[model samples]
Every structure is written in C-alpha cells, then in structure tokens.
Target: MPGVIARILRRTPDTRYAELADMRSGFNSLAAKVQTVLDKDPYGGNIFLFRGKRGDLLKAFYWCDGGLCLFAKRLEKGRFAWPRSDSGVVALTTAQLSLLLEGFDWRQPLDAARPRTAL
Candidate 1:
C-alpha cells in the first residue's frame, strides 16, 4: 500500500483508472477485473461503485507493471457504506479503508473540514 492511497473517490473523473498508483504486480486478480469492468462499462462513471457478487466482498481492480491486480476487502459486521451514485465513488486513505472495512464511519471529519481563524 505504499505510494498508492486507498481512497473512495467521491467524484471520480470520466476516464477511470484501471490501476491505482501504487499497486504491486503479480498475484493481483482485482486489477484484471477492474479492466474488464472498464472495458464493458465505459460510461465515464466511477468503477469503484461497481459491486461484484461475492457475498461480503468488495473488489478493486488495477493495472500496473503491464499486469492486472485485484484488491478485495471483507467486513465482518456489515456491508460497506457506499456513497450515492450522484456523489460518485468516495476515495479513502489506507487508514480510512481500514476503518471502513471494519464498518466504521469514515466520512465524519470531512463534514467538518471548515477553515478556522483565530479571533
């Protein structure tokens, strides 16, 4: 998870990323799936929002080093609190991903990210 961040893009760009920035090569099935999804669904929408049927598994795919990598996460408690289609994919940091994987609310602090000034 070095160099690459585990973020859920709240507003992913039109061109989807088959692979994230820092995914390692070899033994990565998720990346290949992501590419397939992108190839089939090129609506310029976020691929992160796409849900695969695996029962409590969330997959993220990427292409790196001339290969594909697939990332999977499973929650012991509940399903991921995915953002709305209108909001787009919500990007999360590694730490945030950890929290989200455990079914915690990762978007709380962001709601109050207002600038502060000393009076």
Candidate 2:
C-alpha cells in the first residue's frame, strides 16, 4: 500500500504540467507530449507530474531517495480540482491521498470527520 500508485481524477489538460530537472520521467511519448508545458518546471526536489490521455488522469511520480516510483489514479465519477494556471503543481503525501480518496480536501485545515472515540 505504501508504494502503490494513486490517481487524481478530472480531465486535466496535458498542458497543465511542467517537467523538472531533478527527476527522470518515463511516460511514453504520448504522455510526454502532454507534459510539454512542464518542460522546465521545478518541484523543489520532492515530487514529479505525469499525464495520461484517458480523461485527464494523472500519475504522481516520487522517490524515497533509495529509488524512484510512480503513483496513478482515476475518478470514475468526478474531476479533480485543478490549481490556477499560473500556480505550480500540488504535492500530496500518501496519507493525504487516502483522505482525498474519501472526499476530503487535503489542502484545507480540517479535523478528522470520523475519529474513533473510546466508550
């Protein structure tokens, strides 16, 4: 579960992502074309971005210093909230992805909606 791929839903345009120099991207040529907007983008050396043609689906590329890896996901019913065109990409943690999957906005300040309580 820790190294599994997680997806962001929404038909995001291929031009939304900018590539970084600190990482190597291994998406196919089609995926590469969609990432042209990110040709020289920077992620502060923590995250990477990838785009797939199937309705704006994206995969998050990341590494733990030991090696590199990719995480992918898709929304069967809705689109993801994209950042402003002028804004940089959003970075997410594994825990954050789990929250987002349950319909929580990971960027906002919120308490757990279903915290367990001792009887």
Candidate 3:
C-alpha cells in the first residue's frame, strides 16, 4: 500500500485538512463546499478529508483519472479520533493521516519494541 499511498500523497495538490462536513454530502455539494473553504481547486488533485458530524464517518475527495473521486468510510464502533479544532481545518502528517484512515489514534504513536538480554 506504500506505492498507493505515495501516489495519493504526491499528487498535484497537497494533502490537507477539511472542516467537519455532513456525511450525506454528495459529490457536487462537497466539491463546492470544500473548494470554498480550501480556496483551492477541487479538481486540482489535492485530497481533502473531512469527518462526519457524528464522527463515525469520514469523507475524502480528490481528482483522479480525469474525474473527481469521493471516498467515505464509516466505523462500526468507535469514532475517529480528531484534533481539537472543529471550526476549521488542521494539517496532519502522512503518518497521522495513515493512522486516521486506519481508525487508530494517530496523535500519539506507540514506541517501537526493544529487545533485552539478561545475564
């Protein structure tokens, strides 16, 4: 998935944060809304990700293959952990973005395991 992730991250537009929006928002409404808030072209290839009002669903919009693509995911249980900012967008790192997509707490990453030898 690294290749796919690399492709998505390194597109025409840079990855960015989008304010929370309605889950029912479809292509047209979201495209226009996101464009307005971002001040960037929706079709310019930047991937805009938004959390749902209830925080259970996530919506992603971007341009791909000569068309616009909208990706949405809903968690069956826990809500997606989001930053404190709710009024506007907040930037996220690639690792954070990945963890967010995977429904994990990206804010605090776990430390790597360390092997120990005892005499």
User: Best TM-score goes to which candidate?
Assistant: 3
At residue 72, candidate 2 shows an lDDT of: 54
Q: After the best TM-score superposition of candidate 1, give how far the Cα of residue 8 lies from its true spot, in angstroms.
A: 15
lDDT of each: 0.43, 0.43, 0.75
**Least well predicted 10-residue stretch by lDDT in candidate 2:** 7-16
Tens-digit lDDT track for model 2 on 1-119? 32234333211222224333222345344244334544532222344555444433555554344544455556666544333344454545555555544434556756668857866
Off by over 4 Å in 1: 1-49, 52-55, 87-98, 110-119
Span of 10 residues, lowest total lDDT, candidate 1: 15-24
lDDT of 2: 0.43
Clashing pairs in 2: 5-71, 6-72, 7-72, 7-73, 9-80, 12-56, 18-38, 19-38
- RMSD to the true structure for each prediction, in A, is 8.4, 8.7, 3.5
Candidate 3 Cα outliers beyond 4 Å, as residue runs: 1-13, 117-119
Q: Over the stretch 39-76, how does candidate 3's per-residue lDDT look in tens digits? A: 76888777788888889898878888899877777878
TM-score of each: 0.42, 0.41, 0.78
